[model samples]
Every structure is written in structure tokens, then in C-alpha cells.
Target: MDIRWIFDGKFFVLDGIDGFSARTSTRLASDEEIKIDAYLKQVHSAHVFVIDDPEVMPRGEIEGDGLITDIPAIAIGVRTADCYPIFLMDIKGRTAAILHAGWRGSYKGIVKRALEILFEQFGISPGDTVAAFGPGICGNCYEVGEELMEFFPPEFFRRRNGKLFLDLFEFNRKILEENGIEWIVPPPACTYEDDRLYSYRRRKDKSRLISTVEILPS
Candidate 1:
């Protein structure tokens, strides 16, 4: 369990040691310290949902890749196995978001869509935003096919010994910087290489790791 303070709230990154069930492991790992109020069905799309009221928001029923909220004590989360889990926070505005950034979701601009929601709904600017990335398959371990070349720019792809790899962190970082988000916490361990974490690409596992964020009660 990795916990940090962001947006004056708890941001947790749970590994796959106990099990991949978010409901079970996440609560147990955190010792019931935090509760995930909202999450998504995650269809690898750019769709983002705004949670103005957690009491009314559906959990795990909506099909989207990202979730944003400004409400206090209401945690938002995303599940991933190898794909990146991105946490976005507007420190000054007390808003936070969690994104499930898989290849399809990233190619579809999930990060951009989340940022748009922060600005449009909360009036939070990019300069006031900060980002943190959880475990994911690193570029060195994330080999991709030539078909991806049609979606991502050349800079995102790298060739090593005739094989191509994609850097999802850099891809999303570029989008954030281009929009004026300068504070980005460098990504941590690689899910594919780290056995403690879950990796669908490495083992075709159905289980997932859950990363959540919330606004602390004021």
C-alpha cells in the first residue's frame, strides 16, 4: 500500500499482493481508512464523469475512463492492470480526478478530457493543477504493434532491436504540459516488471489494482 497526501486528501495506490479485487483488497489494505465513492466500468474511452454529488453518482455502472470531483470525503477511483492510473488534483480548488489510461484510452485523449472537466466545471486552471502517476507498464516493457503508429505520434514510439515500444507516461505528460500543467510526479514502478503488481499484458490476468483519490473534509 502506497499512500500520499494530495489535495489535502488521501491518495492511495494498492498493489496485488492479497488479491486483485478492488472491493476486498483496497479496503483491507487501507484498513478501511478510505472508501471509494465512485468508479467506472472503464471502456477504454475518453469519456469522463463529473461527481458533484457522490450520494447520487452511480458506482461501477457508468462506462467511462475518468472521474472528477470536488466534493469532500468522496473518493474517486480507477482500476488497472498494466495500464496507467493517473491522479489529477487542483490543489487550490480542492478538486481531484482519477483516470484509467490504457492504450485505447490514451489514444482517445482521456487526460485531455479530464482536464477539460476540471476547468469547465470547477474553474480550475492547468497552472494550479498537479498530477501523480501510479504503477503501469513502462515503455521498455510495453511493446506495441505498427498499428499503433497510426494513432500516436512518432515521438511516443521507440525502436529497440526491431521491436517498437510506447511510452504512455510521456504521451500523457505531453498533453498535460501542453495545457500548462507543470507539476507532474514522475511515475513509479512498472507493472509488467513488478510481480507484486498486477499486469494483464504479462500474465493475461483479469484481476486489477485500484488507485483512488479524494478531497479531505474541511
Candidate 2:
């Protein structure tokens, strides 16, 4: 239920509590301040959408895994159960982005692709951007298939008791750091371990936690 701030407090990032799903609504409660102005259909793809006009305010109609916008008051978000909800913001607080990075999206390079879009569309450089990860299945709990070993580097995978686990946080962090981004904030909690957040891998819950970020209105 606690809210976290990032980007030198110019922006606030929130990870939703259990039972509240963005698939049903944007605000966790009617009084919630960080109301999501736009969210995606979230197909677990690496595709990202650029929101430039306010008329396209609530864009849940779009099918993509990532969203970026410079417009203040327009909170963009993504829903996740065990997948990581990654947040991105520029140093000057001029732009913000949210990505839904499941194994499929991450393997397809969602983080790297979002960074490229930030530079190509908004002229925001990775060096000027800071990132924060929301609660997700931790490396210790995320068991995976052997085929993943073929896609991700060996360092991201762990073998224990004949099972393979993937460190999604570290995998995404490598992409972030390799692209020149620094000041990464680790997740506050692990979804699968922390009962406060929803986790599909743990309970097979149909509900998801919505993670959102908004540039404070200037």
C-alpha cells in the first residue's frame, strides 16, 4: 500500500496491491492521485507506444507492452502478475515510460527497445534516464524451461535441484546498463514472495497489480 517516488521526486511510481487489477480499472480507488491516463492491451510483445496528444488520453485500446510520454498529468501504466513492471524517467522529469517485461517481452528486448524509442521519438538519452523495477517473481522463485537458456545468457539462469530459474531483474538490468543507463532502483518487493502483491506464478491469480508513473503536473 506504500507509494514510491523516483526521478529526484519529480515523479511518483506506484505498484498496486493485491486484488486491484488495471484490467478492470485504472484507479485503485476513486481518491487515488496517480490515476492512469493510458495503459496497453499488453500482449507481452516488445512494442511500445508514443503518446504525444492529450486527446489520446486513455489508450487501453492500444495493443503494446510499453508506453512513453512527456505530457504531465498523463499517467501511463502496465499491468503485471509475475512479470516485471519497469519504470523509466528522464533526469529533468520531462518524460516518463512504463514497460511490461515478461520473459517473452524481455527476450524480445523490451527494455532496449523502449530506450531506443525514448531517444528516437523524444530525444531522451539513456544517460539522462533513471529506471526502477516493480515487484515481480524473484530469481530464486522463477523456475524456467531449458529453452530459455538458448535465448538468455547463462549468467541469468540458475540451476538448483534439477530446475532452472531466470533472474529477470538482472537480465533487464544488463540491458539497461549496457545502453548507458545508471541509477537503477531495485524492486521494493518480490511478487511471488510477498503476499501483498499478486503473482500469477504463485497463486494462478487472474488479477494483476498495475504499476504506474506520472510526471508531476507543472
Candidate 3:
């Protein structure tokens, strides 16, 4: 597990790992090294869940693209191969979440929905949160069809010799900024461009990178 810890504490991003797809809960259940429980992630369909909801807390795996929690020591994770993984945290509110924001999910407003939940459920304001857009396919490598291109903002698309590429980072950043979240950490790597990271477009396999966020117990 080539994991990199970021975000000033327990948040982690699994990097350079080939062919490892341990389900979020499965890893947490088997983990003896870390003292935190994990929330299983179900991604890519544009769903969102509040971990405190009576409806969400008992599930072994959440059927959503996003998960948020104020629960201490319970880590929320999102898995991605070519899609973006967004980590959101409100330090003073002691709340955090991770979202799987692929083109489809982004078009469906996953980040906006997650922000709404944080503000409504945890009394967190957008300015109070800091976020990180983790490694994924970069615009230079992410060519898309017109159908997909039609949903994005003009600035998020690049045309090269009539081929269109989608800038996933800029697309999500626009959404975050529109929602009043200005403190976002940009992606450090591109999955398609960097062989050290796994990418669906590059690998055509089940291999994925897991990004997680955990608030320490008080």
C-alpha cells in the first residue's frame, strides 16, 4: 500500500499501488494498525449521504458518491481510478466528507449537495471548510465526446484539432468556488499522466486509488 498522508493529519491518499481494491469497510475491518472505523463508499451514481442520518449509519456500504460525518475517528473514504476524489473538512465544526466526482456526478451536482448537507446538518459554512482535489485524469489526457462536453462550463473544455478534453479539476473547482468554498488544495498529480498512480483510462483494470478523511476523537 503506497499511501500518502495529507491534509494536516489522518486524511490519506493511496498512491502508486497496483491492483489493490480492498473495499473501504473491508480494509477498516482488517486494520489493526489504525484505531479508526471506516465508512464504506459506494460511488459514481451522483448520490450523497449524511453519516449521522439514521438511514445511513447502519449500512455496511453507502450507496452514494459522497459521504459526510461529524463522528470522531470514523473515516470517510472514496475510491477512484480516473475520476476525481474530493475531500472536504470543516475544522471548527469537526466535520468532514469525501466525494467521488466523475463527470456524471459533477454534472448532477454532487459537490453542491455535499456542501448543502454540511451546512444544514453540521452548521458548517462554506468559508469554514477546506478541501483537496486528489489525483485523477487531467484535462490534457481526458478527451470526451460532445455529449459529455455539453454539460461543462466553457472554460473547462479544451479543443485540440477538433478533439475536446475535459478539465476535471477546473470543472470541480468552479463548482466549489461557486458554492463559496475558496480554500481548495489543487490536485498534486494526474492519474493518466503519472504512471505512479492508477487510472481506468490508462490501466483498463479494477485497480483504484482510495482517498480518505477522518476527524480525530476529542
What shift in Å separates residue 131 of candidate 1 from its native position after superposition?
0.9
| Model 2, position 188: C-alpha lDDT score | 68
Clashes of 2: 0
| Each prediction's TM-score versus the true structure | 0.85, 0.85, 0.79
lDDT of 1: 0.76
Tens-digit per-residue lDDT, 1-218, candidate 3: 22332332222443322222111221222234333345445646667777774344524454788887777656666767878888787857378888888998988888888888888877898887777778778889998998975688788999999898999888888888998997777776777886656788987847667666676565
Q: Among all windows of ten consecutive residues in candidate 3, which has the lowest summed lDDT?
A: 19-28
The C-alpha stretches of model 3 lying farther than 4 A from their native spots are 1-43, 53-61
Q: If both were scored by lDDT, which would come out higher, candidate 1 or candidate 2?
A: 2
Model 1 C-alpha lDDT per residue in residues 1-218, reported as the tens digit of each score: 23232222223343321211122122124425546778889899999988876567758888898988777777678888888989887766378888999899999999999998888878998877777787789989899999999999999899999999999999999999998998787566787986766789988988777777766665
Q: Point out where model 1 deviates above 4 Å.
A: 1-34
Error of 1 at 143 (Å): 0.8
lDDT by residue for model 2 (31-111), tens: 253467788898989999888888876567778999988888776888788899888878676888889999999999999
